[model samples]
Target: MTDNLGRGASWQAQSSQSWLTVTASGVAGGPMQIQADPSALATNTIHYATVSVKSSDSGVSAAQPVVVALWKGTESVREVATTAAVASRYTRLLADPVRPYAYAHSNSGMVADPVRPHVQLYSNSGTIDVYNIYTGALVKSMSAPGSTLGKMLASPDGAYLYAHDLAGRQLKVFDLREGQVVATWPLDASLSVFEGGLIDLIYARPNGVGVLVVSTGQVFRASDGKLLATKIAQMPNTDRLVHGLQPFRGLSSSYLAASLDGMRVFSTDSRLYMVPNTPFYWDMDYTETNEGTLSVTKAYAANLGTTLDAGLSQAGGIAMSRDGSRVLMLSAVAGISLWSPADLSKDRMLAQDLGLQSDTLNVTPDGNIVVAGSTFGQGSPQFHVLSPDGRLLKTQVTRIAASTVKPGSTGTISALTADMAVSADGNVAIQSAIHDVDTNFGYLLTFAPIRP
Candidate 1:
């Protein structure tokens, strides 16, 4: 990097390949160098590395690939070098979600710690797996004597994990760093008396400060699992905004989306609730009126009859933006729809033609961009980046071993498993994918948006 314009210029370099390392990370107004070592090759082969550069002034970044050829003690009879068009579509697999058990293993559990880079994944075998997203490595797994694990929640500071043991009727909090169970609280004995059994424990959530057990209607301090409140409906009244936590019965929502603070919540059931950040609570249930009509009612708010089309179903997912300004509804088979929280009016529809069929739609913490995974249909566009105004900005694909698609195929011949997470800045993303029959395993991928 150089400062030819006489103004201060700073540059940072990152290496995409393991064999390559940035000798000089942050070089300002001078020469920056990267080192590569590939002398231990047993056979002649070519290795590639991509070096990304970015200045401190702008979010835009650039990358260039460095190719090197290595050979064994014997001279190579043939040498082949390939050059592929390189955009900022840099995606790399971190690792398999669960390496030990890959056969018929689906990621049934996942939660990101609010304050740390730690991500907890639940496995089918009654184990809670934890991984550090920043390091791209599996830290550890926590399991108990029971096989029926309900829902898991992380503390705000990423120091603890609260998990519900439905079989044992207990809530356990683990210290993430030590990988040890710190506290355990027995569930309400009356819970087992419910007609639906103990499965209702699945609606548990851990606010940064305390854990809210929806099934049992109890709140526990996140630090020690101490009983904070017996019932969520009976919390001490305060003036601050209380985080609204409501578990709708009989609504089989496959996915649940909530604010980072764990306050506001919405599901595919078409119901949205906002809880006061303090101890107050408010919940609204969206009910089906007719074959194609829906209506919402509030117990406290009189004269409030809200209705909408019964288009929302299990095939789609709903999300409330971080800013609480917009609500996004998504279906991989369908397209995208945005609505206003104030009046439930349609705001903007990204249209199914754009291939917005992602497992979920996530808005950046700043609420600037809406990111979602894309499949083969609709021009085979990859993950899409949408501006606040709902304009397409960038389209990127995971860098994985993909099978060749027919000239015109309707299905997703090569598509991601629809699992992804975007950074708070909306500049980078980490996604999972399973590509090609040769490698029928899932891989974690990280990439940045290709600036136009």
Candidate 2:
């Protein structure tokens, strides 16, 4: 079941199964390679990726070679060999019940080999894997001290990239071109520090502000690598709120979207504050919780600030559009909340708001949306696209979230299963899951074009 994609062509992900082989025209799928489903195919009028998988293209059957198959439209393309996919003994001792960690790009782009479009991998294994966007082959692996790397971000110029080592007690910056360590900022700058659990993510401002938000609740300027705010991290996610923004185990990405493009952060606590480098420029204000209330405090936002646990309840799983105008949050109410730096007051709910079960969210390059909504207790989700007018694009039905029959669901719609992504053009989408395991664990679902 290999497929191919066109230039900037978007695909509407029909279903998410497991262990199936899929591909794009000339582009090949590989580990760390970006993908889009058949139904939501988006391309820039280029080559596609050819896919190669196991059987019936059904559910994923255990761990196999290569993560996905890349294709353009129809012809067989390439394969991201899973040969390098190693089995770790660490699971024997400290394994997570479900998916423990995942990756996120500060910007929206293809997940191909490092050669074609330049793909970067942020791992918990104390290193960043730079690969070929077309082949998923490792171009260079950047090493960090004795620490598992957290979220990562790259500069607009693609010159430098940064990550945090929770155990190494250091923030590492590597030269993307040189593929070597450029600078290491340790906690206290005197000695390395190790914190078992730390929350962190990177944001590259369109203006090149490149900022990194750490779990210790600190924000650092990714460009010059300057420490901006140390106290802003505490304002969001109060000690209270049972099952608030926190999720199962160490699995969720901190729900803070850096404002390097702006000047504030909407913390897990849900309060939007003015994060000025000066700090003392203005006093921070508090806000109300639950979904329908925002308390204003300054001349800027009358009642505008980020919401508490309502949007992204999961510890991790946070991302923003290329322009930073909208925030795609995951968990609970589980939908994308569209907000702008200009309007601090009202927040608009786009796509999957009307009776659609949502588990995660992602913004596409073309302003469309890719949402994963499943039924098998967040298992088999459908990928959907909502046009810029806030209306459902293409055919009649709703976006992909509820587009298909959810896994483990006999009824209309049950829950969302996995995550979603779009191409640089936002015309194509890739959706699938792991299936055929002890508990139907791995499944693959991709959305490609049926016709022009």
Candidate 3:
């Protein structure tokens, strides 16, 4: 309670329900405590109450009613199912935004159809096999002639699937509704020849897709094969000297992320680069040995003070919140730190020295929760759920049984890799854990309704 008449006013607080208690009632306005007792309440039942506050000053017109809601439910996550064993390693896990299904990608070029939630596509040589995600039943198979597609990405609207045709040296855009290749564009022939190809893809505004090439960036029109922007990577003079410009000659991007609005793209090599999506805005020009002089920029290069851990790079060490307000970066030396997207400045250290070496990081669609997973070391692999403001919410360990452990030298239950994906509604999550020794065999775990 506060006095509007600039006079120190006395206030009285009362709770509407017996289960809700208000401490320090009938006192001068400053602060008070409200507590809820849930011991007598039934599980999974929501209870509501109101805290009424009245000011002694007559100038304050009406009493204020503060509503409070409480619910009692399970706080820990439970394992749902384990996937069937395979010989190829699972490289990534993705949760469908529009459906109740999850996709597990493998190193052997397997991806899930974003438009069709239940479809899983796998590539073998030039043949593509489509299967059901839940039942492992083969639905249909198709052929791509001479093209071997890899590094697949789905458009934001789930209308097209963009993939790199490694054998053809081109980018193939497959229309999901038409079920055919709609368009194809030639990539940098030099990079394809040297096995240095596109690293990642991010959605750009105005119906464009930003492609992160080796040490360079480009944007293309998703509808056709028109190139909108090119040669988009450049670093500051100080950053070039600190990281040694020689390594950048052949540096490959370790990770790439974009804000939700698709106006900015973030890429990492030895440091971070925040590239603007505005076309034809060249800030600097630099000459390379074979590529000639190219236009670039140093407008938003950020030095994070520490070189990121290489081991965690493949496990996705960087992520942007859905609202594009927060950027989370995890380094083995610094743990996880939150950064503001507006200025690329450090907001706060979210977590550090968490015992387990975290390898993967993700944020919920609502940007309220942060999830991090660790690689197995001396103990079972674990994942943590946290708030954006740096509060730990839940911690879960895989706890694989010995019977499920593959036969090995030690016969210990451990995972070599673990990755997580949260649903669009922020209520569910799926985790994939690869076996320590087997490498190919792994387990899939699910957490539903993370909060009640």
Candidate 4:
């Protein structure tokens, strides 16, 4: 119960059912506690009761209805029975692609193609596939040169798909609508050294300037990928290179998210960087001594004027609303935090007492709603939707794993099965699982709006 009264106000809680008990006789401008006897609940039925509150200042009284829902074993809560609907479900992702590693951990494997009615998935075998998500029909497929694919990013206009080559030295641009290869750009020779793993991708076009953010840092480019500039590199201590941010490996590290306007980019490590710099390049020196190991000293680079540290120890996910007014950040210990893009200094922690670790976060295009996927094992899997001010509007438990249904069950659920995506309309949500290295498979779930 919340206290909304001004000045000093005393209130008492009363209930008609003996199963409900009030822990305190009265409360003044604070929370009122209530206890329930779970053993007294009737099986397979929803218990209802009315709680009345009386104010000491006046004779005004108010009563609210409460509900307690109980279920039997082997039965599940059906969304259709309530006000929600399940729009789509793909049971096994590994069987269809025929590539076990395709469903493996990817910073960005599945993304809604900027074009309407189509979604893209990577096979990591030099193949890019597009399908109609609503119908589950393959629309098109194109093959590049390498079986080891990096991040797959679509152009802002949905005309082309940009990805790193197998060697991780060059960038390949595939024309999605035209169905052909348009251009391939190569990086500096020093960067050609084989760095195995997924590379983060962020495609942003704010105002009229287009920029691409990858593992190496921000790259400024035109819509056609012709005019390019290396704004930031990995090792150099140049004016544009950012310092104090450590690069990590676990799929989620080194992630990037651009504002709706594309003027700024946010990293998974709780740092924001400005994009669109002048075309220039610089390299740092690395020497191999008799020990056969490379040695180099770090240098302090010039700090960019536009940078904000949100104070997250390790940010797992970051997202910005379509209007670029609000931001959502998710970390292991801090739960979820919301910040105002206009002034990030003014921020608030949302659902801190949830007692669940979140793996991913997404906000609606309009900046009105935010959703987060919880860690699988630490607690029951759930998706939390909240308003801009951190008010929780809904908590939808995604699933009950086999292990949880019956301890010591046959199959175990991966704690990394939590991934979320919100549609542009803000009415539909698609939740899926990504292989967490040890597991070789994943599943997908979709939710449509009946009413919010």
Candidate 5:
């Protein structure tokens, strides 16, 4: 990274998870440093470095800055301040290979962390405050990764987080216990690795065999970052943002459900092929018997008061019922289209069109019901309740207009675009916003499904 500025000055800081913040500017031929947050002093540290650069004139921004860091698993050793700055350890992690595939798995399957309250963030940039099951207030805040971090796989125990760093062409693993990085791996982007730095995660198959990491068109085993197969979902001529994680419990066999932009479900026989477009999306888990097959018999996203899509115009988000028998459609302008999982041709419409709209959708694990952000017509969308078949169970305008969408790319969620996930028991349903807004600080905050 270079600019017209030739000579430069930069500093590097150290901590469990190190970061660099521009501290002092314009040199005064004197001492200029940064102080650590007094509150974080005990938990974190304040490491600073100052460099003496030879410049024709005293111009800060006119000069370039450099930084280097180090990340190693050791004591809470605060880095000794240095006169010469270093870079972030992650910058050098690639030199090693065995540790790159580490990832922090959640308490459940390799899906988004419910401990997270937002919709769009990965566990690294996790905007979650995991609390003790007994007392819920504040635990440590695990942030999302670089917002661009993609292709994550959790350890079989759901304790470690392994994410492919598309930006750096490397794999980063973190220890959830300490919320710190512990391993790194380098990839050959020139090989089965896809282009455009587009990588996403499918569930780990066989529990321990390995999780699938899909990028552009290539797939790899998340466990070893080894290339598995390429171009599984060979969909051409369309740019789709997929939302898939190992279904809460669909890891028994080699089965993985791939959702295309909240629409279309493609069940693969080693690749992403069109299976069926239905009324609901399969969000939670349902383990099959010893025969090695899980049946789709339920719905997760609700449609009652929320408008769903059977057509393109009203298109919004599409999900399968937990049982995989129905489809739950969230419409942009109208009602939801309840389609059969077996045949997209068959459909049912519930809840009249027009009234309001919201971006996020909340779904239960069993596919029995759902909830949506409150947005009655043109005003900010709020929360509403619905039956799996698209009935107006309830309207919650005053309840959740401020819902935030999930933006897990960072350690926080701030998008207002709302999304949902189910807990392990298929009982607790969590709805969150993908995008965020300050006006609605904690909309929905995190929903706990009311008992039947």
Candidate 6:
């Protein structure tokens, strides 16, 4: 504490709450120490207290009040259940925003329907199989020829299923309720250059679906397969002097994420790009002939080496909190860092020096907890649950007993290919352990009531 008038006066501090104690009171213009005892605090509650400092000098008019807040997080979660082993491992997992259901996408070409809380959709060749998500019971089967269900995304209302047809180089929209392919639009010709390369697609709210390949971004109407806006990376004028007027097309290999409101799209190479003015165009009707290029605002350099290159080939290393308050980037070199989506400002580091390799990143819908999975050079897989401001709440390691390990295996767990998801209410978290070599079987592990 410092005195306002530069007068070094003796000051005494008092705490409003019993849990908060002032360790040392000193003269103004010096330092004082205070501590908080949360042992007796209730879980999942935020407690506030004030420390009033009164100076002995009469020149100081009023007592200066310092506010302190303490939050007692929910109790740590313990492993509750594990699903039966299956031949096909799920490479992708997601939790529904409004339902108590989890979607698991198997490597054998099965994807859970995001709209239907209890239904799973599997596409083998041209046949679509619908099954119950929980019971593994077959609901119905339908066939749609010439459609490949590679990398599917559901519309906000769950009315349409947007899928990429790699073989045909087209984007197909399937009506979930009708169980039929309603529309098919050819992808941008420029995307063909990335033929076998990484391409990302995300469903933005307010009826916009963004397709990002490297630095090129295209927005389409979710209601129909109409191309709305196309944006190319615009290097700064300083960079143009060195590289000429050519557009910087290769910003990132594949990292892509959008905000909850669908107003902005984020992509990163070494630097972060918040594609500006996305909602303005999508909110209006712009035909292919009338469509114009979306403006580029600014690009922020995160200074983290190879931001999302390591262990992020199949899984997205970039994610936005459900509340759209924070944008998270998982780096193998720098751990997990949080940024403000509003301005692309570095907020703070949530966790650092995670390991040699870190991959999966996710945030609860309420934006309170963040979960990430990492591995230490073929060691047992570990997952960390953390608060928004960098507090390590819990860490769990997946270990298999030596007797349970598969023969000829090293018994080490790898999270390089793992995927994780936390429920909307922050009560449940699920992780897919398909790449665990010790257990040749693929399965889902569940951690329930993770938050109060």
- Against the true structure, what is each candidate's TM-score? 0.51, 0.50, 0.58, 0.53, 0.43, 0.58
Q: Per-residue lDDT of 64-162 in model 5, one digit per residue for the tens?
A: 222221222224321111111112111100000111111121211123332221111233332223321111122344454563354444443334555
lDDT of each residue in 119-157, candidate 6, tens digit only:
233333544444333333344544557654455555544
| Maximum-TM-score candidate | 3
Q: Candidate 2: where are CA atoms >4 Å away?
A: 1-84, 88-118, 122-124, 187-198, 204-210, 213-217, 233-254, 258-331, 353-360, 376-382, 392-452
Candidate 4: residue 69 lDDT (0-100): 19
The C-alpha stretches of model 5 lying farther than 4 A from their native spots are: 1-136, 143-157, 160-166, 169-178, 182-200, 204-210, 213-215, 235-316, 327-331, 338-346, 349-359, 377-380, 397-452
Question: How much is 402 displaced in model 5, in angstroms?
Answer: 14
Position 341, candidate 1: lDDT: 52
lDDT of each: 0.42, 0.36, 0.49, 0.44, 0.34, 0.49
Which tens-of-lDDT digit does each residue in 1-452 have in candidate 1? Answer: 53323355566677777777774455445667766576554442324445666667553233222222221224322111001111111121111211110001122334544434334555435565544443334556666545445555554334566665656667766676576777777877655323213222222232222334343444444435555445433222222221222222222223444433343333333122211101112232211234212112221111111222323322345566766676676755446666655445455566556655434466765555554555553443367777666777767654422222223313222334355544323434444443344243233323323344
lDDT of 2 at 439: 30
The lDDT, on a scale of 0 to 1, for candidate 4 is 0.44
Tell me how candidate 5 scores on lDDT.
0.34
Model 2 lDDT tens row, 1-452: 11222122222222133323333222123322334445544332223332333433323222122222223333322222111332221110000001111122211111312112334444445555443322323455556646566535444334565655555666777775577778876643332232323344545332223355554544566646565545443332122232332211111223445443334444332212111100101122221234112121231221322344223322223455555665444433444445454443335655445323332344554655545444332234444556654576532111222223244522222111333333323333322222222233222222232111
- lDDT: the better of candidates 1 and 5: 1
Q: Arrange candidates by lDDT, descending.
A: 6, 3, 4, 1, 2, 5
Better of 2 and 4 by lDDT: 4
